[model samples]
Target: MRAIKDEHRAARHRRRRLSLAVGIPVAMAAAAGLTYGTAFGVFGEDAQPRASAATAAGAAAGAASAADDVADGMADDVADGFASVNALGQNGTYGGRDGKTVTVKTLADLEKYATAADPYVIVVAATITMDPKGKEIKVASDKTIVGSGTSGQIVGGGFFLGQGVHNVILRNLTIRDSYAGTWNDKEHDFDAVQMDGAHHVWIDHNDLRHMADGLIDSRKDTTYLTVSWNKLSDNNKTFGIGWTENTTADITIHHNWLRETEQRNPSTDNVAHAHLYNNYLQDVAGTDITSSYGNYSRGNTKMVLENSYFEGLNNPVTKDSSAAVVQRGNVFVGTSGRNESGGTAFDPKSFYAYTLDKAADVPAKVKAGTGPRAATGVTAEAASSTLTVAKDGSGRYRTVQAAVDAVPANNSSRVVVSIAPGTYRETVKIPANKPHVTLQGTGGSRKDTVIVYDNAAGTPKPDGSGTYGTSGSATVAAEADDFQARNLTLSNDFDEKANQNLAGHQAVALRTAADKAFLDGVIVEGDQDTLLLDTAAKDKLGRAYIRDSYVVGNTDFIFGRATAVVDRSVITLKKRWDGTSQGYVTAPSTPADRKGFLITNTTVTGDVSARSFYLGRNWHAGGDATLDPQTTVRDSALSGAIRTTPWSDMGGFPWKDDRFAEYKNTGAGSGTASGDRPQLTDAQARNQEIADWLGNWNPTALNPA
Candidate 1:
């Protein structure tokens, strides 16, 4: 044993003996319903009186303090180090505080809310056994999963925080018993908590032990994390951080108890800043569990170890030659093998503020402080409701329409129906009663979440009543006021070539027939009549604002009578399903006294032949001569596919009879002001701006232009 010589060793042991003597009586009294203050008085004249049982019962269950004073400290503490840095416009890891709170006792309810689109504070109320052993529940961003006192337990399972997920907290739970009776678990990759490429996470005050592989596995460059006040024991590979070759992970591990662990307490590999302080590591010499190493710094990791107590068998502090380790103020008793510390590491104080406990008091403090505490009033209250839709049955609903249907009718506040990243082959509709419903996609990109159908205008209905008309053949129809869709794709996959035997090929992808509708960062794709922007009635005022989105189609794709504005968007003109390149971009049929369609600051391009596509055509609905159709394409980049004479007549309605014009448009397709291609004057173009088309409804306020 290469134990460090210290003159104060006897004094430290005496203090530990006194603490244990005093703590035993207090614990026995508390468990027996006796007076806690009376027993805690054994701490002599300097000790403060313990709190009453009623008051202590309301403290947070994860407080990393002694049982006598667990009520008033570290229960609601924010994370330190890189996790405290402000990123993505969010300051620190405040999980689910902005959303509603819910309690779940079953695995189904836990998985439903944990993988939801909206933020939630989920309280696990009971010991939920995993149906399939070692099933890892995938947790989404902006979530808080905490235990209700010490009753919450997850057996034979764990949680997975995937890539790009952020702002999550896991506290006050016991996740264990995933060990499949194998010391070297090669079959199962079961871990108590695992994260890959996730950031701004806090894992605190939990009891993690007997896992198949690692108690906590932070892999693939997971950063900005703090694992504090946890008790990790009874297994090989207690904790393993960093699997990536890149040294980008930043983590803080403090105030934890590593008892009877074989190795990796914890092994820090390829980490940017690994700060370990105020922890206790103990290993028995004759037990089956023997520590291979205590705190390991491997790869290009930079670690700072301070104020810790190590009572171990072998290799307490070790580092690779390529790694840096700065150790200070640590007491090593009865240790052997390499106790090496060299190279310069970063100062943690530069990133965040933290207090350190003395090394002599670490073993005593960590034993009493680590792991879950008693009950505390840290549970949040419910706010707005959020429903989740996932194709994998992990969320509350498997389909978007089911989540939408679950929303209460005439709801006063907003209800977000969050769609997980997957292809949903169905139609979804938001009725007029659901006004503040927002369909949000939880994905990295808009292309990840897809809602699609294959309905055509001439396709016969299943009821045999009649064929679905142009308006009825929509994949997603929003008939509610104040409706919004973001970060998703809506497509009508109607094959015109395959359906040649059918009559009409007008397949619509999306339709909005209400006021104050907004679409942002979305993809709408189809062939003909792809997007129908219409009103509930011919005389009603229906306005739609689409920004930073994509509209793809071939023939007369965007046609309606509503006052609509497509701003800062992309219009992709595609070939017909029969491999031809002849189609019209828009067929506007505006009312006589309404603003028709404004395509401003947009890019119109596609993979079609030059001069094969027309900018628009006049469409008088049902050949109604009283309707004055209008379309204005201005401040946009037109492609070579656009015809020089962009306007054309439809259904015996002359193009000149309607309002079809362009202003300040660039690109090869744009032409000079001729009688065939009307051009708006500088003064007239101002009246046809996006702001004028949207009226007092400021869609830009919700989603910036």
Candidate 2:
């Protein structure tokens, strides 16, 4: 068998001799309900415990000392000198989506989308000049800039993106200090957009790249805005992201992507109010977002990332702040570290690294103290939250993964663990054999807490093997049964800015092989394999119930042939930076006869226009993958951001009428219930294999009920 952990082996040797040094403590802990799976030896069984410690920061950990006390090798510092409560969530304090009713063509036209009276819609083109006097962007209390992606490109820094005007909107355009084909000797000190003292702004659907300074510089004043659906990349030889020192309140950077840049200072100086959500970030070659200077904080940043990808990056001080990168469901392939330590790497295109259970190359685990290698090790009870794990003096351990690893197999009692409010960066696994394991979060609200990671399928292994499926390509892999998660997010932040379009893209955020798994108020994110609910099991009725959640992805996101009922959730289509068709919805590779998927009461929204995305298509498994006719979408909102036809077609086969179906849904992406459509009536929607699939499980109440 694979070599046992050295220390555990030695402990067994001692236990055979009836030693009490290790055995006594272990037995006591186990009796106290701390069962270390596959019990270790009495002495010298485990290799030395890996390096872990406790400092004065917000987190503290405890463990029985064997080698000079747990304090010697353990360092209390969180990930890469991580500080606490630094940045926050998106939509900064605005309660809802900006419902502006106007067609904008320039920066001056942006006041229309605002909650104020004289709202303008700012339209930009191939190259619009910013008034050097800063008068062009001007002074507005409530203004909106909507670039008609087709008509305009705003150029030069005299007025860039922000300049101390409150309640403004910058949408749908490429805003950068254009080189004017040649370097403009006239471009001076003005930022592309400067938040001099701006408050309540929204920067959406704009491409801000290749600048001398920054895509955004918000340091002065209480700036509150939602920066969504914009592409912030390739700021090489320049600054990519900069949040200078100041009291910026409630800044939400959601749906906007950042990649292939340099000098990314996320938490530069002291800042607050940061909401980061689903956006593709690749090859980010700078400092992690969110600097650690001050703690002008509130509860915590609503840092959410769904259906985005983090491919590759060469810089390695951090893939990102282990404390700040609340990554979910993003791919991280061929990811490498700039440091002299450990980090994985992957090739961008060959996500298909393995086939039929054969072994593939694997990348090394990230070295400690670099990138996410740094972490916050806290026992379950360290913080206060909604869910709480019950532990005792015997069951003492530092991190969440450690506690789960300690659970005994075939235990008679169910074990439920609680996580407090904090962004924990650890790769956790619920073993296939460990049943009755439930991971719940403890936040005042479902959207306030999280557990995140950014491990791409193609990262490198320490032994030089391709780290895709070799290392389990998932940040959070659930192989156990009866597993349930609530009010928290599980993500694989293989953000491309950090991974550089290199994270072999097929990163699985939630890899499920469990039976009767329940996920509620949970968010799953990534670019390609965001929510991989895999029932590649021998059982036929492997079921998953996901509700009140949001799943965002660019590619075959909700893939895997698992039988699942997605209810009251969002299966969002991710948009591309170049304004291309981002991607489609479900690609269920269900074998015929198995109930595949049923999506109800959800919304399909994307950053691009309605013509850029499709509904359901052939899930790449050749003809075996029919569009299965099993999958269905009903009673939901389809945004104007989805393309209607060409639902599913592979290399040779056409899956138009095979599996995909829709019903009684209305919204921007909704169409007449006709041709090549299986739009269900309210009656049929309540009673089919779709409704009867998850018996007693109301997915329209969690359905496949």
Candidate 3:
């Protein structure tokens, strides 16, 4: 239905439908001489050849009513484009497990349809080979093997039989890696599928391209599942592991498609309960660990990876590295997580002369910072002690919304406004009674400083109906309430080649809506609506506190439905952060007692490390995207470039317990954990519920090591 393949505009609409079906029979013979020239004088006196036959039958019925109004305006422009296109097919169709109807095309006829008391399903469309020495796909327990895609592939090396498998599904199909190992790691054993401790399942789309262990392996309970769209590219050691702790729950993943990819295994394997969305990812930082660990977890766990996307990698995300955890966790990243900053942070001596000789210094100031520490040292002989700011200064405000419209709304006094570095375009908001507004950035090394802009959604506006998704578009919009900012950086530069499903270019580089906001060491890039933190419908208690922040963009770039707290933040990505990242990750415009978007000790990079990403999902919409599941994340750090059933479903319903969880995280995509991580014992993580949504927050003031 999304046919974007135009061969000369569909051959000029088939030669205008062969000139309107041969000009509607020669325009109905010139409409019978225009219906005998308007009925030729009512047939009076021989009526001149009967008035040319009534003007050729009234011009053939007015040329057939102007060709039926040009095919009824192309059938109402295809019924208004399928009524705003959203047929929303989101998978899932073969109910009846063992009522029987199998047709497996390979993998040993799907091992004669394994059965843990009758598990069944094998819907396919093509490619389904697999048999690297036979005996693998041995799934049992309630089963499902869906693939119904035209080009649905599933080449080779897929095996899942870790004993007594339970509810299952192997979806979509496209599991490559026909066994070509030998990186000397002892043949690498070849893999494109494997799920030993399988349980409730629901893999979707499926497309583990160039695999070598792209998707598989979940021990123990195996909990709820729901993988989303699929596509994993290239390969040289892919991943998505889990063992020991064994616990996989409400998993979700959206859109799909990934490139390059690396880190097949950094430390302990992982790919715990997830929910990743959007889709489309390029380069992916030329593989490798790419630093920024992928959606990590261990022991207790609950995951959520928002609208996805992450171009060139290099630590697009990170958290508990060197995997090793017992229990306790909860993870969340909404407003559609993003990535792609490279403005400067991979510090390779200025990127080896900016890539050897391109002289990468696109600088008027590539974020520098060493001039604000003297709002009081200006008296000693008027020395103002190293105070410098004036390329147009009052602490420089060339427009970040005129320093948030010169904050001072419903103030009780607390105006830090310092912004100095540069790149300050516009589009900022902080309304909600500007309580104690703060936006430090007079340079304290947030890599110098910046604040770009690039309005998205086609960037037209003025009622021209362009940028800002919900008809609003953005480029820095706040909603106030103890708002605070730090170090500094916020971009949008929207220009996806000119646009490519960024849902119509709705760009944004920060659009918060108040609560007790406080973004430190900030830096947000853009692709699609990057960084929106909307209180959408407001109050999940509403309060943010993104520490050591950093965000990039693609789609859903940091979504809304507030209640923030992305500590040690750095949730990056390159592309594939689908406006829905597909699977799902914080669509919670919130309601159910309000609670959504709460990334903890965050760090989730993406450059495709085996299993492409997805962390959060099932976010109802204002008035219910299925609220709460209380978005959460604790002591985070997940690598392995995720996407193995994270969590999705904004309205398809099926997410129980309703409160994504994760805890005691480790690295390399930490996979196992129980009771939804976050084992909270130390006085329930500092007076509970992450300090009541960051208001009187105190988690060691987020100075976590």
Give per-residue CA lDDT, model 3, range 193-278, as digits (tens): 66655444545445565544444444444434444334555654444545555443334433444445454311123434333334
Q: Model 3's lDDT to the true fold?
A: 0.45
Best prediction by TM-score: 1
Query: In candidate 2, what are the lDDT values of residues 398-443, reduced to their tens digit?
Result: 2457546545555433555556666667778878777666666555
Off by over 4 Å in 1: 1-385, 703-705
The total of clashing pairs for model 3 equals 157
Question: What's the lDDT for residue 539 in model 2?
Answer: 48
Give candidate 1's root-mean-square deviation (CA, Å): 25.2
lDDT of 1 by residue, 27-62 (tens): 332232211112112122221222222112212221
Question: Clash pairs of candidate 1?
Answer: 58-376, 59-376, 60-376
Best-first order by lDDT: 1, 2, 3
Q: Which candidate is the best by lDDT?
A: 1
lDDT of 3 at 656: 42
lDDT of 1: 0.78
State each candidate's clash count: 3, 133, 157
